[model samples]
Target chain A: MEVDKGKGEAEETRKVAEADRDTVTLKSSDGKLFEVSKEAAARLSTVLAGMIAGGSIDDNGTDLKQIGSEALENVVDYCNKHANSIPSAALISSSISFNTAPFKEPEEWERKFVDRLSHDALFDLVEAANFLGMERLLDVTCHKISEMMKGKSPDQIREVFNIKNDYTKEELEEIRQELAWAFYDD
Target chain B: MGRHSRRASPLDVDDLLAEILLCLPTLPTSLPCASLVCARWRRLVTDPIFLRRFRACHWEPVGVFHTIFQSGREHLSFSFISDPPPGSILHDRFSVPARCQDAGGGDDVYTWNVRGCRHGRVLLINMPCYDRKVHQFLVWNPLACE
Candidate 1:
């Protein structure tokens, strides 16, 4: 089954003039529903895209429910905004000097963007990225994951991942001794 | 409770834990602790996955690994192998270093050699095509590429 191009072009054109667009219906696993952006529902979610493309999507201005609703919404919003926004040439040149958008010296808008999320939300986004197969999302998640790894010993990581230690005390000690140097930094 | 309802679940938390541990990346250091969690976990320690890729490095075991087969051994060949079949008669047999005298500095003697060292981290290889000689060797610690 083939979907019409881009969730109806006239609808998108009308919404560009007006903001706070009408909701796209999303169905949840337990037969729940949620209302979200048509732009977002169209662009970011491959699952949603497949539904539309396959002509399986009902989408009649109803609540769009999702199994992982918040996670789905966050991902859609991120993708939609990122897709539409143009990069600042001034920021581009300035960023090149340092090769990074300095997190410490971030713009007010950037700070507010992250401030809205909870730890659980952050984790759910990572899972969402993995589910969506988004590389940019994966990099963000991996960097977030590695950042968590920093300053943490092996035991801490295992615990964080809900991993249980299978080594005996003596064996653990022996292994620790073998990798004693790894504990120290360069 | 009735007799049928009185029985406990067949699978416990530990059983689930064992499956999780077995699914982890095989790191030699983590195996010992992971196996000790329980008998099921202990059984997973012997799984080839835990034994195979887990030994990423740290096999630089200091010892005399070779016999001095020749006084003027210039070059050799090496094969870094992880596991050889246990209790096989051919384990280290047919795998002897055959060495003979080669000219010092500016000489022509060609032979190839091969060896296994330290859970298979490094291979020390020496081959001379002109003089037709091959030498095999393995290093306890393989150095980083320059």
Candidate 2:
């Protein structure tokens, strides 16, 4: 999960030295500091891009009070990795100009990026990604979560998401009756 | 500790969680099971907007159902022949149980015939009911019994 720690830090320090730095510092809700490439942040996150464009970014640490430190760290990590990774020609060509084109599957590295996180961390990253307007991150994380639910039953899904079966026994029976074909196939 | 054992904050937001579940591959099976998880989930799954999005994402029909009426010695039997995957052979079939027992008053025999079928439901018309001259219609979802 610590993606390119030495190189990322070195790049951040170099950006700080330049007259116009290419990196931006973000402060999580808990006051922890994380730095991400400014170009990547703007390109990936519409909210960050707007803040950067409107000069709302505070040099000390752009406060992201809505996101916790762990989630913010994962967001910054994803942005850095995205900046470094190159999209394949097929991926570039397959992307249509439509507003809601089918999203391309996550890359191998991106899959590994989320694969390492605990379920809590994954869900946190999803919320943080949505908060940041990181559409691709949201899609990738959501896809991963859905992948976990592919073959799981209702009881299993409840266990996975820590959701309580709030339906009454009668209601449960009725729903089970309604969707009996689904269970029979299993 | 197990990987999912952490008491993670639940993603309880309807839209957000729906968006995640909407990404599930098998909609017909997955969404129904998901709806049983909770009231909020059931609401989301059965919501008009959510169903529209789910249909848009998962566009293919799972199977086609055909209703066949057979005259038995004692009573008229209404059965549904399922030709799943469209062009495939008839793999599974089952009878649609009589929804209303008293459709025919007194000793008058009642027989059910398919009037129309659409959207995984069969509209059946009951014949020769002594109590009511008008044909009684019953909508039956045969797959629900499977």
Candidate 3:
């Protein structure tokens, strides 16, 4: 009985060690698995943090059914990159002046990270980041999209985003007249 | 994992769309131009909550409003002095409404003094020419042109 008790305690210790791992395995909707630093995942994502805190994380792979494999890969890549990058002085100072700063500009590496993505991949990553509650990643992705929107005509914007122009000619004319100054080339 | 087909665009979600739109450039033409994209975008950009959020996000002064008074003229003319990265705001985009200009009618000349400006609004005090007494107060929103 004592030998059995000792073995039981050893098994319990092994389970606890597994649960206390430094990294977590996540399963994307397509059933692919990715590993991320537990600390980084918890820090970067509110949903992951909640799952971690609530002890709901599965050892095999905590399922993220809303995220596709490609987008989840990008999320993992961003978290890993964020972990390695040092926060710049501007970032630190901006954090201190939180009330005055609306959004912190993305670091250079971050800008490059999202810049290389194809349009579909970028939008997919945005949805994934938003689903994971990753605020910084969402900001970076959204900033890239907004930059694409700047300086484009409405027709160009519609073309780029695959949006259908629903206004009749008369309705469009009325809006143009109402906000004529906005359309001035100068 | 099996490769799946592409998902729907995130912009289909209104909340996500707002997040993207919230980051647009802070120029005066940004929202107005965006409103012409589609009916959905038009509705989103004109929403009071979205406008409030946009104001909060881009709090820097876009331009200045100054009154130009010509001597012996009955009315005060306001001009927008644009501060720019090229085309921020047009000089004539904002104007004092005709109602305010017509307030002092038929020889009862009133001097208009700008009391304050805050949150895209201007407060004016209309004082009768014959006396120092405050005759009336007028609140104006040049953006709405009302």
Candidate 4:
């Protein structure tokens, strides 16, 4: 009976320790593990906040089966970087205004963070950010992609995005005629 | 968590595509130019819901429309002045009809006077040269060319 009582005390201690933990372990689709600050994860990602609040976080490694290892690594890196960086005054004010605020341009650090990624990596990170419900990350990544599209013609956009131009010559010409101003520079 | 099948490509998903497109520049030419990419993009951009969201996202005015009158010309021509100065393609597309059909099934020349412009729409009062009392109100949307 004494040994069982001691075992119960140890189990309670373990639970208490986990409750006090400042970081959470996440498992990628490929079974890789990543550690991120609990505060950062909860603050940045709505899904993570819900998971943490609902006590659904797994102490071993919360499985994120939708995210591959590379993308998950980028996500972790971004969270760590975001946690360390002090948000600017503009960001704080925008956060206060929330949805009504105009789209805020990504900061210089964020620009450099995404600019170093390969095209595939950037797309993968965007998917991961979206799946995890990381709004800021998704906004920064999407902004990077939209920047790639600006000032380019339809053919140039198609070439950049690798999309097929399904419109036949006649249909394309008709659309061009209808919105002639948009295509004048082309 | 329940297992879910992965999409073939991230850009293939409509939600993700909309998110990316939502971040496009606020310029008036952005959507029209993006719609030219493919039928799928055309469908997405032209969707009324997407258009509403686009307008909500970009609430700033991109250009202005004003009347240009020549020294001796009887008709007032409309001109669009792009705020950021887009290319020289703003001429013929923004022109309004100089003549409106009268009750007698004949085209009547009217002098158009600009009353107000708001929400991408231009309001004008058309007064026929023969009658000083006939005031016809015409609201023209240059973006829709209607």
Q: Which ten residues in a row have the lowest lDDT in candidate 3 chain A?
A: A90-99
For model 2, residues A1-186, the per-residue Cα lDDT tens digits are 367998899889865675277889999999999999887787788898889888788888999998999999999999888877845442243212311456667789999999999888888899898888888898889989888877666788878777778889999888887766655532
Give the TM-scores of the predictions, in the order they appear: 0.42, 0.66, 0.82, 0.81
What is the C-alpha lDDT profile of model 4 across A80-169, one tens digit per residue? 998788565533443224424466789999999999998778889999999888888988999888888887778888877778899999
TM-score of chain B of each: 0.29, 0.47, 0.70, 0.63
How are the candidates ranked when ordered by lDDT, highest leading?
3, 4, 2, 1
Off by over 4 Å in 2: A1-19, A87-100, B1-10, B59-146
Alpha carbon deviation, residue A185, candidate 4 (Å): 9.0
| Pairs of colliding residues, candidate 2 | none
Residue A16, model 1, lDDT? 63
Output the number of the TM-score-best candidate.
Answer: 3
- Candidate with maximal DockQ: 3
CA-based DockQ, model 2: 0.31
Minimal lDDT window, size 10, model 1 chain B: B1-10
- Compose the digit string of candidate 1's lDDT tens values, residues A1-186: 134555577678755634344445655444555555554444445555455457565644323342367766666666555445536453233212322322222234434444577646655665556555443443444344334434334566555544456667887666555444223211
Give the runs in model 1 whose Cα sits over 4 Å from its true position.
Answer: A1-44, A61-69, A85-116, A131-135, A158-166, A174-186, B1-124, B128-132, B137-146
Q: Considering TM-score, which of the candidate structures 2 and 4 is the better prediction for this target?
A: 4
Q: Which 10 consecutive residues of model 4 chain B have the lowest summed lDDT?
A: B1-10
Fnat per candidate: 0.03, 0.61, 0.61, 0.61
Which TM-score value belongs to model 3?
0.82
